[model samples]
Target: MDVRKLAACVLVAATAGCTVVPGSNMNRMNSVWFDDTPEEYTPAETDIQYIPINATVLAHLNQQAQKQPLSNAELEAAISSYHYKIGLGDILTITVWEHPELTIPSGSFRGAEESGNEVKADGSVFYPYAGTLYVLGLTTSEVKDLVTERLSSVIKRPQVDVRVASFKSQRVYVSGAVKQPGIAPVTNVPLTLVDAIDQRGGLDEDAAWGDVRLTRNGHTRNISLRSLYEQGAWSENILLQHGDQIHVPRNDADKIFVLGEVNRPQGLPMSRTGTTLAEALASANGINESKADGRGIYVLRNTGISRDENNNPIYTATIYHLNAASAVGFMLADKFALTPRDIVYVSPAPITRWNRFLSQLLPSIVATDRIGDIQNNN
Candidate 1:
């Protein structure tokens, strides 16, 4: 359908639904007039704790933010004591002193990886003089000492060296919102969670760095990359182990919804670094100055579950009101922090966005009708 005709139809549908009351001059109901009484309305039931934004609230919130998140002490201990032990499918190069037959030389013809002793499923490898040595969960230095002791029976003052040729047994898989989702091999050098992420090409642009999940054994834990990188929380950077899974989820769930009287209403993703309420408002192009009440700005935050006086579980929510009509409003907004999934609403929005749209569109509708009539006459 033509835009002119569509607009005319819409206007007619909107304005033509008026019913006049009998024997009354001003009983006609239309867009401009409404006979709705205040008693006919039912306000929604809400348990709102409308706390005003002030220094006291700011201090309390700041104190809560200052409470540092505890790190994994057990994981930290394991990481500190961790040493690379030989596992099945791992390749090891055993070099014997003054002996060329026992050693697999990584020369121009074959690399060390190609000519290395692969650990069997039973975790034992057979060398020339060492026979079969069970080296499972044994470090390279231990294996070297074992080979030297075994060779001492045949040769006098036997020397041996053991090194990992290729690490294929143990790996940590990095998936989800990373630049490259792949596996990072466990090596002699310690591989931390951050190291594995870096190996997989770091986090993607849409990654919620604070929502990373690490699955070890059968259990999983939420690990915040922001705590490690931005807040200097070294303890949060736990070491990655074999069969571990690291997943950085997308930031879609971490977006703050901005609605109600705004110049440009939008959903802004929460930054892993930090995002203030002022920055969120700026992203939505500020408030609708004419229709919205600047002093009645509210931030609705879900504070999770809380118990009522009866001890029964009840859902808890907080409504924080900010008076932004004063000179220090912007300063207050700058200090206010917004969490993920928070909703911002500018109050007293008497006129809706649709009303603005119709006002702008009415002139064009009238012009189009005039043009159509002129064309019909010609």
Candidate 2:
């Protein structure tokens, strides 16, 4: 070699130390190495629970699914028993038997008579005999009884009927990932979870149906839309109250990201039935035949923190491994659920890893040589 070429080789060797391997450097950059003794904020592999994806793990998860807080029937009964209360801006139509003059105005000049009385902001409506009776915070039945008692003094046993002509008082808000997100007016018709959702024009294509959040009063509850529809967990369809805010979160966590030696490296959103490991692989068109290390298929999950049995704080993630070289491994993949935001990585074969290292390393090395040649030519 020429003196200049030898110097360039020496410089490359010195700058890129012999101990510095491309794989280790890339792993560090990717934060893939899990240390036993992790520094603060750096998660340790020991902190993570490593589980082999198998029938036993799948059985355990299936067992947990059986323990529901409320059944579908119970939820339906509770939500169905709800009664509507009168509120401000409600238009009430009160009918007094044998009193057409009092109920419906019949002035010939005005074609149709204005019969409905609008409940004012103060929560009371005006009538011929009742005269601005307090109706706010009262149910339709309660208002009818009150009107009956008030008119009894004027007319002897005056039969009275009260009905909501147009309900416009209370409203529930439906927002986020809905086709038409806005306030849905609560009327005489009892507004249930289903009603509010339908009023807002149902969920968008990108909606995270697995987790629908409902905020009522000061508290919030997560309702699974998937459970309600697919699993027939009708109890999830709870009654919505006034001032309630229903937000359907976007399927932002809806995707399971596939990386490494997969045929297609992309994020596949969970289907309506929920995504499984096998399904995610199928969406990505399975692993690369030549380059993939089927034995090294891993699912990385960050499960947040929790208290151990000793009451000590334990941060944990779950790294699930699957060796898909066998038929049983493929079956296990089908059973293993791929939760939202999960990272499904297919590690490259040993030969492929070397190719990857060289692929990344060669470009920089070539670029450096090109610069050196340009300077030499000048």
Candidate 3:
């Protein structure tokens, strides 16, 4: 190997050693500091916790995993109990048994079976025998009872049936990162978050399945589809109501960025399957065996300022380290869940890097500097 060229590379790198600008967001989010440093080394205002990766930590983290609000049974019950109300512009088909003459008029443009009576702006629908009956704020079953009562005055033992012919009143708007973005009408059948999305032919390729935003009556909530599929959390499939807006956002959580002495540096896409440190490293072909300090594997998690109960701004910056030299280190890495936009870094061996610098890198840099000096003198 060209020893002079190798030394020059190290000299240039050493001259510009790792720097952390104090009070910078980037510094707090991306730390290259060693784990062996004294505890007294005051971190920025952010309460940065440096945790050593171990079995206990993994178990605790797994237990603290956030669970979905609704279970499968609860979701099913909600669906079964859901009832849709009549709204203005809703078309209803009113049927009267054993009274065909009253129900369907001969020479009528639209047949009784195919025709529907629309709920007018006054919240009333005009029927042949029932006259103008109020249906807005009532269910299909309630409308049936009202029609039956009104028909009894005209005919003896009247049986009436009411069904929604065309649902056009209550609807939910679906937009952004979907195959089709538009208003989906709510019918007598139950309408759910999943059903609404499916009606539009499912989400587009760029849709952020993990961060779906739902706005209902000006109140917005975020739902993670990742938790639904992975944890089977049924609550994520919530029932969509009237005037509800659901937007499938594009995946912009960034990436699980891995850098430093790893064999392959990359910004890996975080998966719903819960990407762990070991999986990320494997994708990057693991840390450099020759130069990597197994004791210095660190994962930096950047948390923006969050307000506490007292409304005080709390900066909770967390960094996790794995001592890969230990037998259990790889096991711990396998269980450590990586959050989106996390930064994983495997540092070079401190002693080896310094030795290389002193033996070759430093010499080449000095020689190059002296050569420059000689040229200037000439």
Candidate 4:
């Protein structure tokens, strides 16, 4: 035989070995393959290329929850924790002792004609007798001290009281899964995570009951709401700080999987509304029409167990089988909800076994290419 023909035979043999033939008798088997229904599915040895549906759903849910904004309750709680300080946009009400003429009716020492008392861009407030006094970064007490010293020179024993009328200077941001989201006014009142949520009008219907997150100074901390309310774990209720952001993200982590002989074998989103086997199969693009043995559908799940220090067996695997052709199959599907990474395999028909056997034998026959070619050429 020519070298070209030998090379062709080698190539065909190699390629055929890589091809897989579906089993034909997978549907005809009447006996159940599994003892009990598994809680989770394990991937087959041949499914190295497939993605783990549980991990995919987890990643997807995490992404969805991160995009939500903060609620109003969170904003108010944040504001309450802030210490009273003087900053831009703060309205100060200054009162002068025994000086009705100097004290304007509008509460500003600058007089009613000059408008409200405002902290200037340079951090100074213009008063009638005290001119421009820098008050930025100073607490309410500090501002009063500075003003009294300035007034000592102009008025005879000038008594002054400084109070913040509008708290627009300091604020905290609260967002995600809440009714109202925005910057909350900061005050001397202590604000906790629960108070923040209350200020935001409470968590939405889809809010995650697990962990609520607070971001501040480029650091993030996860606080469990369920632990705080249900478990009575008040340690999870952290005090909010100024410029802190409270976020109540939604729960999107619930999911189920349908794999193996299904056409679109993958993870399907779970609904609180409930789901059935037929529905899950439909979501996974339905069973493989040509390859699936409709008679012997099996759901394989791993029993949760871990090896101890002595290497003793800690877990046992459970399996469940349902005849797709049986009347009770649909009911079983609804009763058995698929968990993460569960494997659903549909066996092939009996003829598929013959085809696979023939495929294996075909490689040997092709090896006799030299004799066949010589016979044909002769």
Candidate 5:
């Protein structure tokens, strides 16, 4: 149990290719920061790559980001039409010219909605001359034509105009990261994606643009609302249907984790626009200058893994090393984009590792030396 003997044994075990204490593995991670072996850079040969952050890689990544995700198409296709039609429980007002007795007029106190004919659960609305007629799937214009034809038999050249007095049948629900999260009615004039969002008071300040979710019929799809406005990708503004749900998700998922030797290591959420590597480091109060390795700042992405067919976990992280020691390195960091779930790791300097090791090991060595001196005195 002597401290010197334990240290000697650990040194021996590590050299003998045996498993030592967990702390001994610190050097293994140290290998990732500074090791410049050429074979690892080869895509076909190695599992992990060591890509230096530079102009070329930044441009490529930025271009790839501009290409919207393929899932947007499926979301757009789900909403085939934006046309509005009559549905059960909807109030319809039919106005007749020069027919005061026949048409139930709204009084000074009563509104047109109060005198309107409501589509019953059976999808039928009853009128004076039209009798009981099914109006489901019929638009306001079509309903007017049908009512005028029925009234023509009673009154010659019956002038009739039909409109939706109240919309109470179909609805599009909006929630999450919006100024007003509530239901937006599907009106006689077709409601598109933008209309529903505007009706709910637009997106909230904390909302992420690309994270707009549209859920319908138990299927959920994502569309980038930012593209609609900024990039002029008008295709994103697809039609919304009855029973459709729109949610502008919060930017929680777009946060990046700053770990290791940063002054204030924490998860930083991205803005509605975006967050670059420079911004992320700035938010973390930059790296610890005294202890951090200037050449070892890394951005590790896709650190997540999927299991192979054999049930073995597979890691395919694309790591980008940034040597802040270089003059242009900080400029490159400004250009590098930080995506959601990325890890910005600033590895410790060699002196830092030595200092930490001595901090842990010196106390035991000192106590043992004191005990030895006490025994000699005894």
Candidate 6:
């Protein structure tokens, strides 16, 4: 071959040798470029928890108060006479005009018990002539009319009056995820589920904001408080019923776990301000400079519950490559939206990993003391 051609051939051979091949050392090194691993250590634990980002966003979204628009059914129900049934913890007072003795105590005597009175286990007071009358559910007018009808037969021209002495029978329960959860009185004051929560001291910090559960009669309905308050979906502020229970579960599903090479490897709570991969890294004390390859950042997402054609359950996993140098990368980190129990990993450079492995094998031989000093100083 000519001298010039020979020289070109040698140069080409050197370039070819250096070219990266899949599964080769050069390829592995490149792979480690953006790996989310620490330089001097392997992941101490792989079972990092996942949290949903949506829940955090929703929580902040519910801070504002919005009036719930009434639906056709709700409107109709509101217009109609709602006869509330009496339950435990109710007291009733009855009076009969003209007939002093029949009027019970002969005058407007306000005492615990007087003439011709009956108290119910569910907190309702009944009258002898009124039969098994449940004054607990009846309004003042309804109770009066009922008593008048019964007295007509017993006494000559009997005029009867009925009133509630104490309101303890009608109550609704608020529990879970709320600041103060307990039974609240449902008095003449009209109250909705939101009002009940407010009366109970609002939702707790860890309460999930997406949907609060209304469990009644063994059936559950999800009400989105955030949407009701922020998105103008007022339908969520449902009117509460006696004995109805509202449960707010903790926001355990709205946090992300960051591990491997991070200074503070732990689970971080997500919020409405939103979180970015970079921000999360910073929150966890950033990646170990010596161990982290800025290029090898990965996000593992769990796509929940799928079914195969055979009706078998299948779980799918997704791996995302994040670029730290680009603005888009930061945006992705912020927008990626983590769910409860999500795992974020950063792989180290090949040289770093090798050094780490060697250090583990022979602590005395490796410069771990210097590495620790550098880490401490940094």
Per-candidate TM-score against the hidden true structure:
0.75, 0.78, 0.79, 0.47, 0.79, 0.58
| Of 3 and 5, the candidate ranking higher by lDDT | 3
Pairs clashing within candidate 2: none
Rank by TM-score (best first): 3, 5, 2, 1, 6, 4
> Model 6: per-residue lDDT, tens digit, 50-100?
332343433542333334453436734753645554445566667778765
Task: List candidate 5 segments past 4 Å from native.
Answer: 1-27, 30-50, 69-81, 105-109, 226-230, 252-254, 303-307, 311-316, 367-378
lDDT of 4 by residue, 29-74 (tens): 2334244757695523221122222334435634553434333455
Greater lDDT among 2 and 6 belongs to: 2
Q: Each prediction's Cα RMSD?
A: 10.2, 6.4, 7.0, 12.1, 6.7, 11.2
Locate the minimum summed-lDDT window of 10 residues in model 6: 18-27
Model 5, span 51-108: residue lDDT tens: 8898898889878766754345654554554457889899998888898666674354
Residue 222 lDDT (model 5): 91
Clashing pairs in 3: 7-361
Candidate 3 residue lDDT tens string, 226-315: 777677777778888899999988766647999877889999887646689999999999888887888888999987888767777778
lDDT of 4: 0.64
Q: Which ranges of candidate 3 are over 4 A from the true structure?
A: 1-44, 66-77, 108-114, 307-312, 352-378
Q: Per-residue lDDT of 20-86 in model 2, one digit per residue for the tens?
A: 3345221223343244664556443337678888888889987676455446675567557767888
- 1-378: candidate 1 lDDT, tens digit per residue: 665787778677655442211111111213343556599775433354668887788889987765665565766788788889899999999988788766854353677887788999999998886799999999999998999999999988987889999998999999999999999999998899989999989999999998899999989999877767765666678877899999899988999988766789999989777788888988999988886777778888988766667766666778888889985887888889999999988764333433554676679788888887787788
What are the Cα lDDT values of the candidates?
Answer: 0.80, 0.79, 0.80, 0.64, 0.79, 0.63
lDDT minimum window of 10 residues, candidate 4: 43-52
